[model samples]
Target: MNDIDAWVWWLVGAAALGIPLVVTAMPEFGMFAVGAVAAAIAASVGGGAVVQVLTFVIVSVALIAVVRPIAARHRTQRPQLATGVDALKGRQAVVLERVDGSGGRIKLAGEVWSARSLDTGHAYEVGQEVDVVEIEGATAIVM
Candidate 1:
């Protein structure tokens, strides 16, 4: 144990931290692994245990501070290039069959889809155009 280099220990710690980062797909663990790598660099430069530990802590904290807010901002960002299902909302579709609350079919996005009226009392006749209000499961709710 005494013969093992301090840098080797730091590298081992970095590898250990990397396992969770890969398994969990969490960015924080990767940050910690980066910190461990920094600590390994410090140890290679003859930094004592205290210096290595401080390097790890400071690097880890700095990375967390920077990455977390960017992650949060990314998470809060609005729709980017809506897909077919999301784009279906508020778009017009022609009723292929009598669409009531009980369920029917519609031609939406060049495809046939199961649909129902958003309002139970209202129904759209075949060939009538309706706006898709929402998609619930495999069904489109229209009005």
Candidate 2:
């Protein structure tokens, strides 16, 4: 083939490859449509018009079929959790010492942790069962 024919063929192949890559990488940029147009233009100018058109159609359809669902799924958001002490809420623990208005120790999920009671009026003795209502810095709020 001559240089012009080679350029046309190169354009055709580049469009075919670039279309899928752009669609997969940046679907929001609308590069797939641009690639499809380039492919069609290349097919008309280059030889093997029938084969080029068929290949372009097949690849464009395949890319659309594959990328749409993946893009939709990726746009979804996940729930967030509070950091630090708030993360330990709803945990069951056993008091290691008498927990009153002041600080004490507790065992939670096989790990010893510092604990305190929200109600200073109540007293919790050793081996008493409690639930972690909230977390405050390095301490657990127990009841």
Candidate 3:
């Protein structure tokens, strides 16, 4: 084969191999999709017709087999759970007590939560409009 044809075949083989490696390593859509498309183009242009089709099918199956377990493992490790004051952001609440520079109390979502001011050294009155900035333990930092 000519140099150009040799280069094309090399690219095809590299992509067929590299795509699966990339999918195994990162498994993200952007990487996998690009790799798959590159491999398919290379195979179609530079490989025998039957080998190109077989390579595409085999590489795709292998990528899916390898990536599926990794995705499943990631999901299993961090199974979604709901808890804590994270569930309280954006909800309206009343300042139950004056917040000193240190801390105060607020009634939010029918629950009383310890609160601190993001604007440090500023005191909030017992009845002030506040937004929940974040939740720390049982305390909600307010703005």
Candidate 4:
């Protein structure tokens, strides 16, 4: 172990940290891996153990403090795009069968879908147009 270079150890640490980043898909581990690389550079330049450890700690802490919040902000940002079943909401669907409180059918987005009236007392006749309010399982609630 005495013959092993300090830089080699640093490189090994970086590789070890990188494995978790890849396996878990966590950005924090990647930040630590980057810090290990910085430490490896310090070791290669003949930095003392104190300097190498300080370099790693400073780099890792700085990355955590700076990058984490930015990453979190981006991660929490919701896309405005609506797709799939969400697109069905508020859409106009044509009643294919008499739609009542119990059950009925409607042609939604050119697809046949089971539907129910939002108002139990309101029944729609065939060929009537209704607005989709929500989707529960395979059924679309219409108003």
TM-score each candidate.
Answer: 0.76, 0.45, 0.47, 0.77
Error of 4 at 7 (Å): 1.4
> What's model 1's TM-score?
0.76
Model 4, 1-143: lDDT tens digits are 99999999999999999999999999999999999999999999999999999999999999999999999998899768889899889999999999999999999999999999999999999999999999999999999
Clashing pairs in 1: none
Candidate lDDT values, in order: 0.94, 0.72, 0.69, 0.96
The digit string of per-residue lDDT tens for model 1 on 4-72 reads 999998899999999999999999999999999999999999999999999999999999999989998
Worst 10 residues of 4 by lDDT: 78-87
Poorly placed runs, candidate 1 (over 4 Å): 72-79, 96-98
Model 2 lDDT per residue over 1-143, tens place: 46455336646556665666666776633445544555656566664666656655666676677877887876884438666455568979999988877889999878888988989888799989999987777788899
Clashes in predicted model 4: 0
Question: What is the Å distance of residue 110 in model 4 from its true position?
Answer: 1.1
Clashing pairs in 3: none
Q: Each candidate's root-mean-square deviation in Å?
A: 2.8, 7.0, 9.8, 2.7
| Selected candidate, larger lDDT, 2 vs 4 | 4
| Clashes found in each candidate (C-alpha, N, C closer than 3 A) | 0, 1, 0, 0
Segments in model 3 whose C-alpha atoms lie over 4 Å from true places: 1-84
> Candidate 4: TM-score?
0.77
Query: What does the lDDT read for residue 13 in candidate 3?
Result: 56
